[model samples]
Target: MTISPIAYDVQVHEYSIRVAGPDDLDSARAVMLDTVYRDFGTGYVPRWHGDIIDLHSAYVAPVRHALLVAVDERDEVVATGALDSRGPAHPPNPRWLAERYPSGETAQLRRIYVRSEHRRRGLARRMVAALLDFVAADGGYRCVYLHTDPAVPGAEDFWRSQGVAVCDEREESGQRVVHFEIPMPVTSSPVVVM
Candidate 1:
C-alpha cells in the first residue's frame, strides 16, 4: 500500500516520518526516556540507569510491535509511538469489558509522546492518523486501544478528538487510567501500480 507523505504547515519545521528500525532504536529510546523523565520530573528513577541501552533492548524484544518516529530535518528524533498488534491483556475479569468491546482483535497504542516544544503543531494528530491508517490497511486489526492519565486534563480530550471513545476507567500503578478505543474503519483496496 502506498501511504502518501502528509503535507505540513509552512511555518512548521521541516521533518520526516518513517517506520523506525534497529538502527533507530537508540534514538527512539532516548526520546522515550527523556519524555518520561520530563513528565515524571524528579520522581523519575533510573529505569536501567535511565539509559537507552536497556530501554531499547526491551522495546526491540517485542515481536508484534511497530515503532514509528518523526525526526526534524536535522535528523533528531522528535516524536514516537509504539503500535502493538494486540489489545490490552484480557482484563482479569472478562465481565469488566461487557459494556464495551466484544472482541479482542484490537491494536494497542502505547508510549505516544511528542516533545514539549513540538506539541501544538498537529504532530501528534498526524502521527496518530498515520498509525491508524497503517493498521487499517494491514487488514487484521479492527480497533485501537490505549490508556491515559486524566490528571493531564487535555489528554482525554485529545484522544477523543482522534475518534477514540472512553470505554473504561480504573487506577493502576498509582495513575488514573482512562481506557480509550477507536474502531477501525473499513478501507478500500490500495491501487496497485506495477
Candidate 2:
C-alpha cells in the first residue's frame, strides 16, 4: 500500500499539503492537540486521543494508514488529517455501523484539524481531498469513515458537505455523534493547490 508521497502547493501564501514525515511530528501534534483541547475541552486525552501520544506509530508507520499535514509558508504545521485502518468499536458504537466497515476495508479519517487562525480558507478541505486521494491510490480501502461531535462549531456541517451520514445518535455519554461514510475512488477531483 506504500506509494510515492503526495504533495500540493498553493501559491497564495505558499502553503503546502503533503504526506507528513518524521520532521513534522512535533508541530503536527501541537496543531492536533490544540484543536482538540480548544473544542472538546482540556484533559480529554487517552480516552479520546491516545493516538496523539505517538502519531507516527498510529498514522505514519502503517502501510494502510496515512497522516497529511498542511504547512504554512514558514514551514509551521497548521493542520492535520489522518487515515487509520481501525474502524469504530461495536459496543461503544452501533453494531450495524461497526459491522459495515471491517478494519481492513475501512479508512477511518482522524485528527482533521485546522488551527483557528487558519480556518475558512479551504485548508481543511484540501487536506481531506489529499487524504482521500491517498486512500484511492493505496487501493486497499473500500470506504472512508469518520465520526464528529456536533459541539465543534461547523464540524458537522463541514463533514455533511463531504460525505453521507450513515448514523447520527446520542452515545451513552450523552454526547451526540454523527458518523459519515465517503464513497471510494473519489468522484470529484481534489482541489489542486496551484
Candidate 3:
C-alpha cells in the first residue's frame, strides 16, 4: 500500500491522536499491515496477517474498547494503537495474561503500529498516552497489560519506559514473549484551589 506523495514533509508535531470510529477501518488497516509486515516480518508468529493483524473483529466491540489513530497533516493515518477487553476478541487472546488476572476488566494493549517513516518522533508514546486516557475514562477497567519480545530491538525497552512492570515471561509456540502490567490509577475527585 503506497501513501500519497503529498504525505511527505509532514511533521509529527502536526498530527492528532484521536479515537477511531467505524469510518477509520481503511486507514487503520493500512497502518496495521504496513507496520507488521515491515517491523515484524518473518518473526511475528507466522501466518498471522489475516487471522490477527487484519482481523475484522477490530470494529465489533462494545463501549469499553477503542482503536486510536494518529492522522498526519494530510488526514492519513500514520499510526494506530488499540485497547480491548482482555478476552476472546480481536487479534486472539494471549492466554498467559488470563492466568495472571483471571478476572476483572483488564485491557490488552493490542496493535500499536506506527509507520516506519514516522517513527523516532515520539508518536508511539503519544498513542500510548491516548489509549491509557481512553481506558481510564471508560470506568471499570482496572489495569493495562501487554506482551512483547525482548529480541525485537527496543520493543521491551520502550514498553518498560512507559512504567509497565514486568509481570511474567514465558515461551509460547516456541517464541519468547514478555508480559507486562500497569495498574490503572483510580480516578478520584479533582484537586482544586480557589
Top lDDT model = 2
List the candidate numbers ranked by lDDT, top first: 2, 3, 1
Winner by TM-score? 2
Error of 2 at 160 (Å): 0.4
Query: How would the candidate models be sorted by TM-score, starting from the highest?
Result: 2, 3, 1
Candidate 2: tens digits of C-alpha lDDT, residues 72-109: 88989988989888899887888988899889889899
TM-score of 2: 0.88
Which residue pairs in candidate 3 collide? none
Cα deviation of 85, candidate 3, in Å: 0.8
Winner on TM-score (1 vs 3): 3
What residue runs in model 1 are displaced by over 4 Å at the alpha carbon?
A: 1-13, 41-64, 90-95, 98-104, 168-175, 190-194
lDDT of prediction 3: 0.65
Compare candidates 2 and 3 on lDDT and give the better one: 2
Candidate 2 off by > 4 Å: 5-13, 171-174, 186-194
Q: Give the per-residue lDDT digits (tens) of candidate 1, residues 79-99.
A: 887676545445432345433
Report lDDT per candidate: 0.62, 0.81, 0.65
- The residue pairs that clash in candidate 1, if any, are none
- Error (Å) of candidate 3 at residue 144 is 0.7
